[model samples]
Target chain A: MKKTTQTPPSSGASKESQMLAMVNRRFFLRSAGIAATTGAFILGACKDHDLDPDMTVDLGSGDIGILNYAYALEQLEAAYYTQVIATPYAGMSAMEMSILTDIRDHEIIHREFFKAALGSSAIPGLEVNFSSVNFNDRASVLGVAKVFEDTGVSAYNGAGKLIADAGYLLLAGKIVSVEARHAAIIRDLLNPNSADFAGDDITDSNGLDLAKSPDMVLPAVAPFITTMISGNNLPK
Target chain B: MNIFKIIDEIQKVDGDAVDRLEYATRRSFLTKFSRNLSAAAVPAVMATIVNKAYAQSPAAIDVLNFALTLEYLEDEFYKMGNAASGLIPSMYQTVFRQIGKHEDQHVKFLAGALGAQAVAKPTFDFSAGGAFPNPFSNFDTFVFLSHAFEDTGVRAYKGQAGNLINDPALLEYALQIHSVEARHAAKARAILSEIRGNADIKPWITLNEGSPAQVYAGDDNTVQGGVDINGIAGKSKEAITEAFDEPLTKDEVLAIASLFIV
Candidate 1:
């Protein structure tokens, strides 16, 4: 007694175009490195800028810092899922395809939400390196998805306390539950009918979910992120 | 000299001697008397005062007790479902068993934290006052009710975060449990999807799902931060609904939970 609302596969196409745009822009910047730097210098030469905009963006401090940190992770996830759906794994069932697409859309929405919420303070689009993930193999792809989802959940759990703003804290709370849902689904696919849903690795002996600090999470995800993302400024 | 002996002697000599002493002399005597007590005794007194203060301010305890109640309900519901013969399919039996264990652990953890303040587990009917027909006996009814309970559990924890804001540790703890509930909700939804052959049943609650509609009422919200996300390019109303899980107020959560309570 239900109909799976067919979400037009726009996210996959949009992601492709976005990647192309980024590649073109990076190519332009690299070829005209001095010229681009000179232009940046002209813009900042008149004012005493604290640091070069080209340098690695510190995730700021306080609530904004936490938002940017989340934005970075969302960017990675959105990109990963976009690729997953754009080129699905071998022997992917129609059911698997549909759920992964839904996950893709959700991640894109999350990425855009953070981008719009943070606006200028938000870090530039992160370049993800999915070299380790073999998109053609179902197990390989799902393994990476599992890592990203689990890490995303723990990241939000860890960062929730660092957000002093009530609005931001509530937003994080809302988003993390979705992340947790995603994590569970992917885990069930990998190891069905097991305690992997709340696995000992991610949960404590008390059954409480693990809350990894920014420092702990950044490095784990860094291998997937090509951009030098830093969370040094996030609240302790 | 023992301070108690001295006080007793003074009382024996004249009942009013201590009271009639100069104010400065009495102050000095009390100061000396306190100094004679072990250093550890001070913190013991302070601990008693802090404990009393914590007991007095029941907001945190109330939040915990409320959580315990929900956990107890979930634990028992799962136990009944798992124990019911043929209610859960062989393929999904382990899943139910694992989830039931988690719920039991949650009850234990929350009860352990609340210590003596933890509320006793209430007897549950699961049939929702006849709203559901033999929920435990029937697998379909059991799955439907499990979905509701898990979804409600997620929102209940979300609603209590504000109350826990003052204590970061408690807030973090509540959030950790909150996500676990969401995961459980998703697992239940996935199982339903597998059984029904409907891919539309997402792990996250969408605007359209939730049997009574009240489970997902207000979850369709798209305008966050006063910006219409649905209006944005490529984003649909459903995407917004799936992106963020909506919170349920204490009244709303209890209302749903109360259905199962006799």
Candidate 2:
């Protein structure tokens, strides 16, 4: 029954919407403040961010464990993107710089959000081993970005069933799509307008994206992460 | 958008809903109207309708069938777009082919998963009742509609995640499809950016930025799990909104899907 309202939000209209949105945010936040201070879920063991790589950072089981798992991945991504932007690859174009910067900001936001959500249950800052990556080369930087983004997407996809809390599941649902978005852009940067953006290697004959369990994801990312991670406690 | 009308309709059904939604989490009700609200004055009634829609859903099968219906629409849309003569440029044929194949596969997967309970595929009108008179024959319109369809697919699967929570395996499957749809969305959005030469159009959605409004209604939401995503890492509101894709309600998604259904 709806038609002919095609002219979307104009700049002036968006500004007004932005103001309206701000008011809604305050009202929403004020009403939700007390309840949002959820009890900190205790996991296996907590470590200061400075913990040595030798120490096994156990991602505690259940819902919090999944959040930590996600946090760990986000940490890896944020760190990688941070370094990429700090010292960009050789011959990086303005578009590349702009896109990667946005990605960096996004990964950081995801990492911080999870860290905040998990509270004390969040795992310590993970130590990454980028010795194998040559940051100066665009190929090297983007290649790793692809791996991390794709891994994050699949890991979140696989971890969905393991998350018990509805809030947490919805949270994972929210972030995984963003990661998938990251994965696609990174892939497109490598091969613009090509099938590799959602290539057959990652997607199956049915076109379903790959989904890997914690066990599967941990090892895929193990090369980049030097810190010991224990996922044995994650929900089966 | 009957967002307010829906709220008014909801008030007739439940009285305390407005009060309850006032204190409820964004995932519950704000999510439904998150994208629907414009810069204009919003009535207090948006909350009750939000909560009612958020709180309602049937069995896993019901959700799956709802999903199957969307997959069917996408599958047929792509199948037609792919077959249209001189529609897709040669450079992007592979991209469109891959996306179409995935949609076809999703239809197969969901149908197989639903088995006998699967609903018959509805006849589709890609024009959206003449919204895009040349969706297949016109390249820009084709990609534009593809973006809308794929993005809608991502949100549609997400809106149903809460329903499948009780069945972990089912939920995981839905999520797998959900991310794949996201990947497709990213591909389509990127193609659109390249086509339209609009640098502002990133692969991820920025705010409630997409068309038809309903498909991308709540995407502008910066709040996640009760946390205001603004000021995190000194990111702009646009980046924060882009970082997290919000869930659309089943009712709104149906409103969108209805446009394409004959």
Best by TM-score: 2
DockQ of each: 0.27, 0.34
How much does candidate 1 score in TM-score?
A: 0.78
Give the Cα error of residue B176 in candidate 2, in Å: 1.0
**Tens digits of per-residue lDDT for model 1 on A5-43?**
211134643553354345434433343322211111011
Candidate 1 chain B least-lDDT 10 residues: B1-10
Instruction: Please list the residue runs of candidate 2 whose C-alpha ends up more than 4 Å from where it truly belongs after superposition.
Output: A1-54, B1-58
The CAPRI quality class of candidate 1 comes to acceptable
Give candidate 1 misplaced runs (Cα > 4 Å). A1-54, B1-57
True interface contacts retained by model 2: 0.78
- Top candidate on DockQ is 2
lDDT of 2 by residue, A23-63 (tens): 44554454442321111112124444334466788887666
Question: Deviation in angstroms for A137 in model 2?
Answer: 0.7
Q: How large is the C-alpha RMSD of every model relative to the true structure? A: 16.0, 14.3
